[model samples]
Target: MYISAFPTFSFSKLIKRKKAQVFSDYFGYENTRFFYRGAYAIFYGVKALGLKPKDTVLVPAYHCGIEINAILKAGINVKFYDVTHELEVDIESIKSNIDEHTKAVFVIHYYGFPQEMVSLNKLCQTHGLKVIEDCAHGLFSFYKSKSLGAWGDISVFSFQKSLPTADGGAIVFNDRKEDCFITQKKPALLTTLRAYLLLYSEHIHMFKGFLFSVFNTLILKPSRFILKILKRGGSKVITANTNEFDAQYVSLGPSGITEKLIDSIDAHGIVVNRRRNYQHLLEGTKHIKNIKLLFNNLPVGVCPLFFPIRVNQRDLMQQYLSDHGIETFIFGKKLHNLLPKEQCPVAWAYSDELLCLPIHQDMNPGNIEYILKVLEDENCPLN
Candidate 1:
């Protein structure tokens, strides 16, 4: 009865979903570049902006750190802007931070929620700053009847974040001048193998079965040593953290396997199921006292990645669920160290209080019921 925080690569869905158009083909092969990881995509996109040295890109104060690392690695300065406690981009904070050296504003669609794209575009246009849409959490997210990644000057997406890919990322230049282009190479074999193995190990721990138990006892327990020795994200089936950005990986493109999976995924089914599961949690959690949902409404044209909530005892609640064979993880709990917490206390405090419950494509109504029962039994806020 174990449930995973991350979506599993389901063979069942693979059978139903036929191979379709590839990323490069859909986005146009000429301007799209793939990468081994999302951070590398960020780096490549930042470099493609044709920004000069000493140019500053304004980013949110609350972030997972990798985006800033990628931007800095591209030989650019970064200035942190405030994000309101509600997780919306603060436009005034952005305005206050913009200056002559500010060349771009990197907007993240946090946890599949859309930002104020129209207003942000207007401001960026007036200030002459490029908009880089970081859609790492926003593959299926949409606003105003339009998809998220296409709203900016250029965009980046991470398939591993939304889909059950071994690893993948892509950078799309809305319009790239000839001088701004760079050729990308395929990823190394070791890099491809490591991510797929992690995906396999994640699948092994996802559900309860006699065969999975035997495999865990015989193979995984002994191989657990080797698995740990292999540098990776949370091998416990919830991979929320990512490795820091590397300069060498900037030239590495997505693997063939990742590209294939992207074309094979059930795009419509994934979006529908996830939205349904999210509504179940939303309606079901109302009676659960002392717990607060991050966003009260599931806006139209938006697909949520996770059900985020703020509770007083977030760690304790996370552990309680883990003990029950249900895994949940926090997002952005560890902010980029360079961001001064004192400058934006609301964002920092918001980070510490936040946790994301699973609402991935694979989950069902029964799983939602089980999760709701667990929250009620333990009285989640336990403050």
Candidate 2:
């Protein structure tokens, strides 16, 4: 059988019921202002405030390009900030970069791990800057008493990223109400249906690597031509590299079926399982030299997206894991080289060393052992 970085949902009956209840209960938003995608929230938020071109928005250098594209799309300038060795935002860098032109700061709770929001919030408050928390990896995860998305002037969550939803997103405001955009809601039905069908298709069995390779080569790759044709009408299509900001503009709140799937996810249980898997990986790798674990907290309030380990032979280690049926990832490969040399020295230095291992809810002890055995083998050479 193939092992993947994440698991496919069986779409059980109970999960469907819970999805709606949890969304209604947890996300208490009325029909104030809704959009099809999360990017529209950003667009509307900035547009409603009458923000103009040349205004700067601070963002972490270690973030997806979609966010930058969104800011750029709004005709706003983007300034990059550094992330700490712990993979949290470098607040000092943010402080140094803020100026009269800096209107907002976009912070991401990377890999479902909470950033030091308490401190970041205080800094933003003192600087009189608006905060936009990117909760793409942080849905259902909390920082302290409040959820990550709740801490900002405006927050965005990617249903496509964390939830079982095939495609959609939510943009929420804490204090200010945004003007409504004429969102095309019906068009999303086809995309969502396609995603759901793919989720349950027989092709899902090869999720380990072969499936991704096949999907990328066979379907996903060729779809660009079709998307180009659709784009002529000013419509955008979702792709693996779809920008975060653009996603926001088009993504809407979860659909009925997606809500049901998310509800069945056992959010609490998923966190518990992930924490257990994290502990197992930590315990198993404690004796391994030249490898550093990013998290300082053993059981962080943040639900981990994956267990990141920094090792010397990162590429070789990734290959080894994949060759043995254990999937690995370079979480922020695109982000490292984008920033200035001096801004994120630590992140850049360690970027090549970082490798994310599979630690999703479906992973178990046997899978963990198989991963560890490969790492512990003395014959495994560095590079």
Candidate 3:
């Protein structure tokens, strides 16, 4: 049972298409545009809000460097604010960093968990700073009965995180004071094909159904050997966040099929299953000895991307889980060089401590049981 860290793709969902809806569709932001990646969407959204390189934007100290890079590539000066070990945006830190040059603040809903948005919004409003909601891990997430993306001046989503797509992302303008960006042309054929192939391989490899098992034995195995023979087998794709933001590909939209893939998505079912799977992990791991669940109380309407836990020895635990075929990883272990570790000790501490387990919609109770069983086993890092 080789579980995946992220959701795997499948053709069956696309074939049973009904409504052409996405998580953002319910937000009804009128002004939404798709992009090749969430990082590109961030770049476009920040620029669209009339923020220039000379202006400063407050971002959390703990984050994937890609968003920081996006703001930097747009020439915006970023002021790193402290995020408490709770992963909530530190409001006082935001106040300390704000100045005349501060035009906006990027609020990341980390791991599909909402921040203190009502207060954060009020604070941003008082300062006249635009709130840029980074929903990279929060596609369908809601905070206090309202959508997480809806609380911001503008919001960006990474569809690939929540949906099974090759390459897709979006930027929704909630209160645009400046002109929004026009949709760019599609990416190169090779780029799109390579992205799909990477997803396809994961789908087949992770597929457990008898139908896919036969196909895997007959088709996938041979395809891997042939690709190896041709030296064409690789999972690398020119998607967002893998490298620095490229201006050349900045305007490019998602692949032609990405929209269709999203259209066919089981939006409601995915939400239900993910929440269910997450609850299973929460309840099953209650008796665990060493690990701490970051957000132990799963709030209603929050769409969790994973079950995150803080362990004393994250590397040891992660390796043990990987060795047992339970895919897991630490989040935000690599901070941007510009972020001072000395200034944000808590963020640095979390960087070394947090581990995220797979809790995607496809995972079942059995998978969750296996994960917990491995955690309690003698070879476990805690033991």
Model number with the top TM-score = 3
lDDT of 3 by residue, 208-264 (tens): 544566776777677666656644555333654374667778888888788778777
What are the candidates' C-alpha RMSDs? 3.7, 4.7, 3.0
Give the per-residue lDDT of model 2 (tens digit) for 1-383: 45566545445533443344434445575523434445555555665556688888898877656666766777888899888877788887888898889988888887788888888889888888888888777876777767677788877776555444555556777756645654545335445545565654322543345466666667764665665676687765443224445444343444556555645556666677777887888888776664578764564576777788777778888887777767676756566234677767766666667788877766777878877777777755442
Sliding window of 10 residues with minimal summed lDDT for model 1:
233-242
TM-score of 1: 0.90
Per-model lDDT: 0.79, 0.66, 0.82
- Over 1-383, each residue of candidate 1 has an lDDT whose tens digit, in order, gives 67788787645534435444445434655666777778888887787778878999999988888888999989999999998877888999999999889999999998899999999999999999999999888887788987887788998988877788777888877766324355777665555655666666567676545468677677667665665765464433222136567576577677877777777776777789889989999999898876789988899878888898887778888898888778887877888888875888877876788888998987889989998888888544443
**Separate clash counts for every candidate:** 0, 17, 1
TM-score-best of 1 and 2: 1
Give the number of the best model, judged by lDDT: 3
Q: What 10-residue stretch in candidate 2 is worst by lDDT?
A: 13-22
For model 2, the local distance difference test gives 0.66
Backbone clashes in candidate 1 total 0
> Which wins on lDDT, candidate 2 or candidate 3?
3
* TM-scores of the models, in the order given: 0.90, 0.80, 0.91
